[model samples]
Target: MSKLDALPHGPEFRFVDELVSLEPGKQALGRYLVKGDEAFLVGHFPGNPLMPGVILIEAIAQLGGVVAQSDPEIAALKNLLLTGVRGAKILGAAVPGELLEIEATVEGRLGGMIQVSGRVSTAGRELATAKIMLSGEE
Candidate 1:
């Protein structure tokens, strides 16, 4: 099983569709498969479908958080939790049945928290970007 599959999240909560690449302290690439039957799509504007912004951010957080926790410094802390997100920009929309590639880069670290930036794209078009923050846990 992949490292992501071993995590606590499962099913719909597992936003990462694929683990494309990982370069410590540099970047991490992941993929997500948007499903037509996704729970949010049902009431998300009905006929007009768009992936929810929160879900988009969550995917970024998951991808970035994985990178942060992998660091020996942060990993030594035992647990980690996503504390917040900032500067989230949804440049385009990702529709159901689309495959998304997410890239997260480490920006810096502060105390028990780590900062990262990420972008999600497909077909050479940008879907969303965000500055993600995560905190070391007990």
Candidate 2:
């Protein structure tokens, strides 16, 4: 099974479409296609629809969770959830038909908390960057 399957999200809420590369506890790369048919897009803008900045951050956090949960040395945490975000910058917007490339690296882990840094880009242009924290039930 794909490492992404470890995530608790269902298909509708899941953001990472494919796990391109994974380094267990170290890092991971994933992708998501921005299809115009997404329900949220209809209300995001009347005529022009852009992937929300929060969604980009969610994509990054999802990949980071995959990386953290796959670590051989660490037992899987239950209900891992994004608990915090810092230094988030929304640099660009992703439109329909864009393939977002997301990368996340595990910065550290303390108790049931994991800290990660991530970036989202498409066509060689960065869309967002952030440092996020996730916590899971011990």
Best by lDDT: 2
The true-versus-predicted C-alpha distance at residue 14 of model 2, in Å, is 1.2
| lDDT of model 2 at position 83 | 96
lDDT of 1 by residue, 13-43 (tens): 8789788888755579999988788888888
Candidate 1 achieves a global lDDT of 0.80
Regions of candidate 2 where Cα sits further than 4 Å from its true position: none
* Structural similarity to truth (TM-score) of each candidate: 0.88, 0.98
Model 2 residue pairs with clashes: none
Each candidate structure's count of clashing pairs: 0, 0
Lowest-sum lDDT 10-residue window in model 2 = 37-46
